[model samples]
Target: MTEEIEAQSFEEEDVEFFEFKQFNKNALSVQLDTDTVYPEVIPPYPSLLAISNTYGYFVAATNEGFIYASTQDLHELFDNSEAGSKELLSQKIHFEISEGKVRCLRLSSDQLTLIVVVEGGLVLFYDVTKFASEKAGCQPFQIMTFPDDIRDLRPNPGEKYNLIAILLVSGIVYIKDYLLNNEISKIEGSKVGERFTAMCWSQKGKQIICGNHLGQLMQYTPEGTHKSSIQPPQELQQHYVQNVLWLESALFVVAYFPVIQEDDSELDVFIISRETKSKTLYIKSPTICSQISSDHPKLPYLYMETIKDWGPNLKCLIICASANSADINLIARDESNNWTSLNLSDTTRAALPLSEVNDEDTLPVGLALDFTCMESWITRLTADENTEVPPVPILYILNNECDIVAYRCFHKDAFFVDESFSGMSPPQKLPVTGHSSGMTLPKRDLSHSTTSTQNTTVLSAPIKTESPITDPIETGSPIVAPIKTASPVFAPIKTASPVVAPIKTASPVVAPIKTASPIIAPIKTASPMIVPTKSGISNNSLSSSISYDKNISSQKKIRTPPPDSTPSRNLGSNQPTEADSKTPHMIRMNATNNEINELHNLIEELENSYIAKYHDRTTEQCFDNPDAWLIGDLPVITSEINRLEHEASSMSQALADLRRQVNEFSHDVHIDYVKTTKDIEHLMYTPSTITVGRRGILQSRIKERLETTFKVGCYINFQRLFVYTNLYLCL
Candidate 1:
């Protein structure tokens, strides 16, 4: 993949370079720890891993039960080009259990104890520092075996003692001291038979909380005393809690349940506040993509890639799993203060040239399990102030091929950018709405109508305009329509060769309407305007009239009046004067012109209303298309129905085969029971016939030990009688 990246030709859409890259090639590799002894057979790959933010170290437990540790230089990895060139400094830690695979690995925040759990119920606790030292040797400091498999382990958040909490598969949780082999307490789960699947320590470490298979949450003190129990809401009664985390003042739980459909699944996230228990936020699976787990062989699990509070205090929860593309779901709050799930698929798609294989399969497989980010914040203010782009935390992704790629989120919206950090320049804060300004203005939807003119050839010669006369609309009243003017006659420009004829100057359009205070600028066109000069001058005056005002000459005018229309309004009144109405004999000179003015006003209102409606429909379509298609889940529903039908057929066949096997086993057990009874009956009769057992035993002993004198004398009488009888029979 790395070779392909370097050689592949990218189209315009593909991003050739990324802001993020892996700091070290050996950061997650077992090969970096050369001193560690591997098993004779092929070693198991890492099933669980974790990285320490403070110490820049990582501990990973492979399936073969080998624990590999590495001391990483985060700066070197995150900086620039030097990251991949350097090898990671590492050490290998060994333990007594060499058989079963590792199940879970967790490290304390203080880096004191490394908790290790393997398959087969074995739990090993190690001192963080000594375990990494060569002199301390390879054995765990303390070990315990549970009756059932260990599901999850969490270190006590309490600063007082170095304690760890382990959840067993048998609905029990144990809080114990890591240093001293002492069991502080054992707390039974809420239900008798249900297992505790998820557990976490309180923010202050004063309490331990665990979620059970029955969807019940229980809190316990360090000494195994029950503090409180929380039953899930009625809607979530059937769902099981898969993961629980104590993030700040909230208990975040990821719960899932199988639907009635053969393979369909649903997931819900419940965030319950510690301060106010009633304050709860429930989120269903987001509709960013289709159901990712619908066709998966295994159900979806929330694998925490990393949790960061970057860019001031923007809490970022990065989750990477098969359910959400390998890019991870960047779950964060949107601008509206609503929890929004942003998929990194689009971000990664733009940054990397992924294969054309099925994205669902290609995304989650063989990617790096551990991801970390810098402590720095890139706040909104900082982003706005910096002439250069704000330094965002780079996301490093490692694939199975060992090729690493990096990506950074693009700041495309003000709300999308982190708002935590302050700006370099002291921000001149603007007053929020409804704060300093108590006065409010109503919002109105305003639309503008643009009139386009027909294209025509340019005369190539500049025309002059006479001094413009200023006329203001009457005060205290609104003007309904623009005053009409006569059209200008075109005078041909003499040229050597005319490539194209001059364009026809269209009628002018009305100026846009303004609110409250209105200033109207007259519409001017490419052709000159002819003002009536007291004389009955030919329409030639229209071409010769030039404006003296420089502003009037420079303004590109829109023709407002319809062609061949007579002048309507007078200079001083709302209505056109009688003299302007007199026209050619064929025109209706007798009709009252007031009706014409009313009709024109009505037509203008109708045009404005049509334009407003057009804009509203366009806006509605933009928002409606996605909601109807995406939220409807049509594509996902179709695919799920097909997949479920196939799964149903397979499960039915398997169930039938299982039933047949059970019947056969039952028949064999019945035959064995009858045979045993007959043997017992025969043995009872044989016992009654064994009255000469002592005599028979004596004869057998004399024959067996005849070679020994003591033994032969002891049985001489019995042996002589047998010998005499044998001799008489022979004679």
Candidate 2:
């Protein structure tokens, strides 16, 4: 019965909890429906997106090769129109590309040039202003095509030169000067089966770091020579390098380790030091999605941006889409030099103003395919002086369903409000009457009607009334609305006035209370009790007497040493004093000194005995000339050294002969290996040398034997027939 009751209680709690959750979810949905505004201007099936920093406009490419650009700023484009309106659609300017489907769209660092990578390894460059113009059709000013399909292209970070790095479908990369239309150099993969998946140029465009499918990072100079290669750690050996980014002295590498179960795959980010060629930090995320059909499988998109003033050790923020889910992971380097992952959906739900839901299981499902950030939307002041405030960056994500979602990135303190006046009471609302006749009512003061409590003090002002207006039958008068006046600022409440005063008495004098002040007076007694003083004097005598005591009774007495005594020796001194001669401690010290002297004498006697027994020399002689002992064995030592040198020379000669023989043997082996390889190749290519089945060979041999047997039998039969005929003729 107890168990059943407990179960019933648990069920009741669960039901209540679920009902609360459902209500909150519904409220959140309604709030989102009212707050979120979807723009109709975004084209369907957005494949590539690029924002212009100079003009504050954005261009998006569809899967059908249609390019759409907003005529005005993207922020204004959505703000000026209502949801489901065709007005925004008309504001968008579009042009179709005949080249092919767009693969990538990038704006030059100067924000003046637009680089478009389309199908068939074609790179088209056009002016940003012209692409977004009101014209119906627009063409690229320059076009460069490669024999192989282009994988990725990056313009040099330096605005001085028009250099571009082009990665091809084959593992080859080309560094070309777009202005001159000439190839500067080409970089190829070092290993046979290695293919580059991602490539990024250094900040200064001095070096390029490329990640290959073999989970290795290769660094190359702009001059086309390989600089160095970094292999992934042992644990990440099975993972493929998908993306690589270079910042300062470290390389950020993104690797994907796919499992048999696609949902169990993980994405790893390695922060490798350039000088040490070792990993300084590593981060991993489970359930990172990848394109199975891609030759170099990778996430839908990976983006990175430097976070300014976030923290001393923050470094940068990495945003990438997670696999089999709609959320993106915000991986950042924390102060502890470790990566922390934050799901975008959870963050958004937690940051919602209407709902307090933060359950991970309730996260909305929508795969983030691509996202871009616009930093020029709004500027915010930082704490530093003499520095320009950077604009707040706004993130725009394109999900798998081709819907655009915008998120505003603001500082955590941006929404903070001052609550200094929050303790004050709010003003009361005024009562209103129903409007029946066309007559304006005069405004009256209601502050006099309200009364203050004993703890609070209220201040009243003179009441002012306005004249009422009357409407005639021909002239109509407008109904006057009540005007809300500002509430009077209330001062802090004062304490209540004193109720009683103490009576004056001669024996026990009472202190007079100030009537102007509201502080209560202290009580007085008829006869005062005395508080004993240290000198044992009464209060009346204390004022009259002026005698002073020569000495304080609280002072402690200290003894003074006689001047005749000699000054005591310093505690750290090693010399013995007169006092040390009379104590047992001095006797012990004398005994220790005597024992030490006896030990020294015994040690000298032992040494002398050892010298006399072993060397036939005095101890003094041994110490004075230590080399004398080695003089007798010098000739033996010299002979041993000579023998060792002879052996070493002979060994060296033998080693040289062995080395020569090994080289000859190796040469012969190489020749034999080459000859055998060629023979094997020849036999493999020759049709006649092909192997025949054993059954076929046996069948051919049997057929030959049967044919021979048949011929011989026929000859024997004819001979028998002739003999038979001759025998018959003779008869």
Candidate 3:
């Protein structure tokens, strides 16, 4: 109970309950190497495995590399307009860098670089607009150092190359150039026990890819050579690859694997595709299993992107985390381009934040109802479209203790609502676009355009829908940008057109690719079955299009047809259709039958208010409220009713000392049965009184057959009945 009201407010100020302990002893005297002697602690709340934002700053980094950052303006601390600050999101220390622990932070997508890395192999980098315009702290004017530690670093998909890549821990690979401070190419691993774990870049940063642990995937060249490998997926062998992404004709990846033949481990994903070089799976999770039965089932955070105004060609999305729930799964992509996933944590529970919306001062840390890592970026300001504000999309979650929140994400393709066209009128202001189609706009303001109280602009658009796919330059097309390819270029394999068709019998291509076209779309043929991975996964009745096809180096073979030879969405209408009967498939079934008739009149007004206010209460007039108890629940119910009335007066003096030891054991068993019947009537002639000492009558016929065979074998060895009556009188 809040530690008994904080030990009764530290015993009403007599104070003596101060044991706070999180001593990193000044981060172990700023440790450099020396293996450590003792004092190190620091987990008073640590685990935040990587997060990185931009556009009015955001940086979390923890697992002990500590980091923090956020001096306001994250869209005014995620749209509440900082509500008179006191900690909507204050956090400070951009870096208390006591040597290696952080592992990864990575911001740069022109938010002007961040990086970090750590785990004893260094790397650092920072310059995030000169550490938020010199409010300084996480000092790293570029470092680097590696003797083998750093595991994954990436960067270099386009900004004309200040390059990065890295990977290390003895499986080697470098690319470096942390803006020309050296090493522009190293690579390694053509075999001799290849290790490599995961890489990205692709064919514009001039190629790279990687993956290895064992579930192979390779390919490289930013001057390091190697190239073609793949193979992966006999259900991803022993697994390992953990995240890859270059999704522009596909590489994606993910991996981790684990299911040692099923005691529940799984984490899959796959894709591959440089135009059907074929790999596919895409998203897996089924046996999630881990609510701490000795915790194991790995794999969380995935994140994807490829957007294009939530519609026509180039959709992707992805956004992961939810092995089972504090929510976060989004996924998207399907008018046959496939992908799905959903849960976007219930459209972010109507935007969440004031530290989970007014729980009355609770979060100092301790938030694992879901989301242990999430990062979605893209900030673009540019307002004055009559003072606009409706783009939404922010994200940044991270919970299992590292705390960090910041929501605003809402997606039904940017605010969808048409439950039967409610229109009681008024509600139509919709121009929302923070980087829509080729992204690149982060110079702060991040336009949440005034107005605050946070649902950051509620459903914002579809009042009666005069075509609102949420503006990628208002649909007819002017917002272009997408193809920043380093490897998702795909469309060249038409072996005679058919990669599993049936999107209402295929037809719509309409040619839409040129706003700086590097050839974007073309992968659309859906229905190869396997969709159902749960959590919402919507489609609203598939009809989407745009598949571009700029001849992506053809490598055909995608045929899969026999699911009863296709053809059906009522193959040419079996009747019905007048715009699908005035578009109201029961409008959420009459708002779920008026919420099931107000839950049957709210269960008969809560059963007549429990029969007119707590029915005939019994149990001492229903616990005769001494001010309704709970000041420590009435001192634990008056010390358990004085410990059950001193255990019923010591169980009534132990039932009078067990009835005086059962009346002295029944008066010593009736005086030892009357002194053994007067000592067997004073041993009066029992057992033929005349002792057969001389064994008369030939030992009395062997002592009467040895006393009738020792009384019929209920044998007592009185020296074996006197040696069986002297062996039956020495027969």
Clashes of each: 22, 3, 9
lDDT-best of 1 and 3? 1
Query: Model 3 off-target regions past 4 Å?
Result: 1-56, 59-88, 91-108, 112-157, 160-199, 202-204, 208-214, 220-227, 230-240, 243-256, 259-399, 404-731
Q: Relative to the true structure, how large is the alpha-carbon lDDT of every model? A: 0.43, 0.43, 0.42
Scored by TM-score, the top model is 1
Question: Measured by TM-score, how close is model 2 to the native structure?
Answer: 0.43
Task: Rank candidates, TM-score, best first.
Answer: 1, 2, 3
Model 1: residues >4 Å from true position, as ranges? 1-47, 67-97, 135-137, 259-261, 273-281, 285-296, 305-309, 312-327, 334-337, 349-731
Tens digits of per-residue lDDT for model 2 on 1-731?
A: 11111000001011110000111121222111121221222211122556543445556555454345542334444444444331223445555566566667776666566787766666666655554343546555555555556767878876534778887767678887654444567777765556776788888878888877777778887778888766665565556665566766464545444323263354555555443434233434443333333222333334444433342344455555432234444555546555555433332322212112222211111211111222233222345533222233444543322334444443333223211111112222211211111221111111211110011111121111121112111101111111111221111111121111112211211122222112222322322222222222111101012232547442222222342444344433334456766678555645544554465578679767754664544333553454664554434445657999999999999999999987885575456444433433443455365445533443344334334434544344234333433333222
Global CA lDDT computed for model 1:
0.43
TM-score of 3: 0.22
- Model 3, residue 56: displacement in angstroms? 8.2
Q: Give TM-scores for every candidate, taking all chains together and pairing residue i with residue i.
A: 0.44, 0.43, 0.22
